[model samples]
Target: MSKLSPGEVERLKNSLKEKGYKLTPQRRAIVDIIIRNEGSHLTTEELYDLVKKDCPEIGLATVYRTIQLLEDLGVICKLDLDDGCGRYELVHQEENHQHHHLICKNCGKVLEVQADLLEGLENEIESKYDFKITNHSLKFYGICSECKNIKNK
Candidate 1:
């Protein structure tokens, strides 16, 4: 009943082993919750709330530790929306850089932009400045269509 694919589970296991850590059941439950809510951008407290539904005995400290461990192992990454809280999402294997986010200023809804819209800009900057680009994060703030529609009504 694991949310993670077998391959993903094995990969996590191997990564943990490489770091001399074991994937305990509690850790597994936490990871399952993260995978279940892939785009949630969950904060540690939010994650703990969801994880508690499955693991009533799990502590917030455990969630914090596991999150740090997973981030350290590159299984996930932290995101700061400048909203006074740090959020987290999975580190997709296929993406060279994290996808951009569009945050609604009025309603505070966050939308993901799957396309890497800055590729050309990155290339231009690299060629112009002779700099190597490793990665980048971008977030746009504006009113979403829903908010605009509501306002226009």
Candidate 2:
């Protein structure tokens, strides 16, 4: 079941309205899937397939358009995990920046690091370089503990 609340849906509706768009049924299904699989980092094709199960008559082009619309509205963001595929994840409203990702090299699993571990570094760089950092994306790749444990066994 989706963790999306009614308030969140209303907020999304308001966002779309502000952008001269509407939350159609197909679009709602896509958004529902995205919310349900919050950390899945689904690709456009993966999202399309999942939406097809719910909206059998939906077209790929419509999915693409909705993705573009949502992205333009800053409701989602694209991530590159160096896997030759672009993945999409929601831009959490409460987060000042997107959380970092830890990708397991062996099992190809991705874990989210909720801690903002780069504040000091970002501050140092901003002061030294006279730059104002607005946002950043970081990905760390390594073998996860589960993989290491399996290897030891």
Candidate 3:
């Protein structure tokens, strides 16, 4: 899925309610920013900064707590984008599937791509060891074009 649709958000809220988790304002704001910054791979601190722009009264403690709760509810996925920041993104129901991020070491930029391209390895693992694949993360580290040109001088 591209991002959480209005229907998806309402469905998520209802699901969370069923699981005994309420979608309070704090949680809503936190999730909204995560969805807006879909591919940005934002850390909780970064998320808090974004939220504070709209809800100045939101505390970092609350952001932290809400992030954990939302994560537990499967509305988003926590990512260690290999940039020293634990980031997150909304779990888009229509998207291909969860994937890993590629980080530009010199620029600290993040790019998300599908993990399906690794089917060869996935099959190898299953065939060789009967490991029945479920999921995995693969991060690549490199200097992006801009950084490469800057350092070439």
Candidate 3's C-alpha lDDT?
A: 0.81
lDDT of each prediction vs. the true structure?
Answer: 0.92, 0.91, 0.81
- How many pairs collide in each candidate, listed in order? 0, 0, 2
Q: Can you write out model 2's per-residue Cα lDDT over 31-97, one digit (the tens) per residue?
A: 9889889899999999999999999999999999999898888888999999999899988778888
| Every model's TM-score | 0.95, 0.93, 0.86
RMSD of 1: 1.7
Q: Sort every candidate by lDDT, greatest first.
A: 1, 2, 3
Better of 1 and 2 by TM-score: 1
Residue 72, candidate 2: how far off, in angstroms? 0.9
Which pairs of residues collide in candidate 1? none
Between 2 and 3, whose TM-score is larger? 2
Better of 2 and 3 by lDDT: 2
**Candidate 3 vs. truth: CA RMSD?**
2.2
Question: Residue 35's C-alpha lDDT in candidate 3?
Answer: 74
**What would the per-residue lDDT of candidate 1 be over residues 1-153, giving only the tens digit for each residue?**
226668878999999999999999999998989899988899999999999999999999999999999999988999999899989998877789988999999988999999998989999999999999998999999999999999999
Q: Please report, as a residue range, the 10-residue window in candidate 3 with the lowest summed lDDT.
A: 92-101
Displacement of the residue 71 alpha carbon in candidate 1, Å:
0.6
Q: Write the per-residue lDDT of candidate 3 for residues 36-91, one digit (tens) a residue.
A: 77787788899999999999999999999888877887788888765567888877
Best by lDDT: 1
